[model samples]
Target: MLEPRLRTMWLANAASGAAAVAVRTPRPVFADRTRTPRETVVASDLELVTVTDHSAVLTWTTRARNRAGRLRPVPADTEVRITSADSRGAPRTWFFEGLRTPYHYAEIRGLEPGRSYRFEAYSDGRRAVPARTLVTRRSGTPESTGVFTTATPPPGRLIRTIALANDLHYGEPASGLFAGLFEGVRHGTDEYPEFMLHALLEDLRLPDRAADHLVVAGDLTDSGTAEQALGVRAQLDDWGELGRDYFVCRGNHDVRPPDETDHWGNVFHPRDRLLEYFAGGLRIIGLDTTRVRGAGGTLAPAQLAQLGELLRGEPERPTLIFGHHPVTRHAAVSNPGGPGFVLDRANAAALHRLYASAPGVFLHHSGHTHRNRRSRPDSGIGVEFLEVGAVKEYPGGYTLIRIYEGGYMVNFWKTRSESARRWSTRTRSQYLGLHPDHALGSCADRNHVVLRDFSGLSG
Candidate 1:
């Protein structure tokens, strides 16, 4: 009964409806869903610490929430990838399954010795930030390539020597206040630890020839807190493994007061807390100078006696002495009567006289007023008193001493990364405005020196 045109249109509409029902009934696009990428990701507590010959450890934390609601760990289905390359540009890749934790840690191993490696962390096929690590060479020999260059084997009996210096405060929070007191200046950047560590590792990873041993002079930590001490220890551990044998001496900042102890007792003491970790072939005389009230550093009567006996009794091997405080005039950063910065004058004189008489003492290293200088005592006993710059401060760098058959080379480098340099310039200007006199002494000397080819001891 319907019109022919109406019938035709109704039939067309029914056919279209049928097609729509067929499409929506089985494979509906709206039924299943895909998630959009997160708007914000917060990464924090990033640390590259606990380095070794074949391994390096990394730790970081992610915020509890993302824009949507909460941040969940990368699922087990997700893959975490790590890639590394040595200074020579050789690359290596490692893969791991993602872990579920606000705090994530990863240890990358199977690395070459004495090699510097750049690394990147990745999750879900997206790269995270980049970091760096170094592997130590095998004991008793230096790496032929990569981090170190070829060295001429000793013609005769070779005596291995390592340089020791300590107490360079690189990124001291109060650096601005003490800027004039310590001539060298640098800023406290967010990347302070990284920049300082890089400068030190570069020196330790120098090519040409690796050191037989390395010793930290003392006061590596600014404060006695576990966190500060741990930060310093991480760097030294990396260098130790890199340089073969590494040694440590205790400083005041390395000591923990008794009040801080819990049921387990004091966290760090002169011998047990600080020195025991890195004691190797390098003979370290851990002197407790922190006990002396209002004194730069002093060896207890018993300690001095013990040191004297050790110096006299030990074999003809080279010896290096490290303490937090300096013992003599040139070694002290501040003069006498000026806050008692160096060793008491009387004690310094006595120690110098003893050292002059002792042939076993090859080098004396110290760090308090963070600066770098070399002093030869009036005794003319050939012992070198080397003052190292701070790892945390401006002109921020470390002293790299290379010992060869006839003589040794001393090099000063700056921890002047793009970020660190900018901070240092600002800090130095501010400090110079405050205490100009504090900038006096060898610390003002910005040049790096190389003392080569003086025949005496072997190593």
Candidate 2:
């Protein structure tokens, strides 16, 4: 039997195979009806999403003719069988039943590296035309391939390079639903969140400059569903070891009403608690500022006390603070007023005062606003409040951080996947047709350099 960790990794890597495939022109398949040939099933747009050392994930659409003469997803029963192209082993099959949609997803694990495989689909036991072939990548290969590879694992002595991503909104079913409300944005993409995240992991895994540590600032989920949060954790696991190389926090979207329940009738509850970790000679803190009501947030008295203790524990330690909401209102006329732009301005001011007094605190990162904005406390606090754009929508990318003994530099990198970029462009209609470029403001919003004496930090 496979080890439990490896098994979980395999399952997580394959959970949303549907997102990896694109919808292609349907291919017609014949069926026998009363000794007469009739068009029955149509399947197309098969795509090989990610290929690991021992597994591959594929997705496509399978449609069947309806009484109205329309091609709809197969209902009652549908099945997919994936076998080694060379017939080197028994085929792995996936079975689906009950009312269904045109989308189909499947994963094949335990395959050798640098190998090839074939797959076919069936609707009620009838094979649906031509089979597709997939070629897995060789171990250690980094560039793109027909079957893409997973992100490379973190390397040794990894404190130098860190990556930051925020506002993922993982479970948001649609965008611009709050149109004419706060932001008056009315654009959203139909792409699955899992697919966007998968592409991000791959983009971050470039061979020459992979991040050693990745921190997701907040809004890991849109609906606070434990399942969605768990899915986010799984994708993060596929990128790096959790709790060691990665950390996360909570955002307003990750909080639901007291009596809220998911589609399955399960009551909504917070997924992640206050998170704190130490790595690479820095104290990384993830604050849960979500409140019970309203779009704004507040830090509980207990959390504030904890923050005070943490800061006082090592006043000289280099520290980084991250959360969902910003501590100060953005310096833009297009930006909203207090509590709307920053729900907890009072506490934010308090924290800034504390940070200004504590020279150790240098960076505060957040992502509530879907656009990029940067500010420092007007009171002359040295901390840099950097807000990143949403990962699942426009300005789709992450901030890459490189630390040195002297100073640090940050660069914003687009997800680099053609599919992700296209989706981002499609969502530019958000915020009342606000151009997508607004999410990615001038260069200053995405890039920065901090020159300070970090000799106090011991890596």
lDDT, each prediction: 0.46, 0.59
Per-residue lDDT tens digits for candidate 1, residues 1-459, read 333432332344344334433442222111111444343344432333223334444444344354578654332111123323324432333424233333344444444434455554433334343211111122211111212211222233334545455654423455544425654433334446455555555444543224556666666555556666656656666666522466656665555555563211132244423232222343545455554234356666666766666667763445567776766676554442343676666767777777766665666677666655565574667667766666655445555554545444444444323333334333433444432223212321322222333244533
TM-score of 1: 0.53
lDDT against true structure, model 1: 0.46
Worst 10-residue lDDT window for candidate 1 reads 141-150
Candidate that would win on TM-score: 2
RMSD of each: 20.6, 13.8
Best by lDDT: 2
State the lDDT of candidate 2 residue by residue for 1-459, as single tens digits: 333432443344344233222221112323323443244666643434334434444444556677888766553233555554566654445323322334443444445544555555555455544222211122322111222332222223234777888877776676645634735232344344666677678766654247877888777777777777777777788888866888777777777677775311132223335667888688888887777677676788787777888788787788888887777755323454345656466787778767866788878888777767776565787788887777887656777766666666666665534456445544545655553435655444555556666765566
Flag regions of model 1 displaced more than 4 Å: 1-163, 168-171, 179-194, 206-212, 241-244, 262-286, 292-295, 332-339, 376-378, 433-459
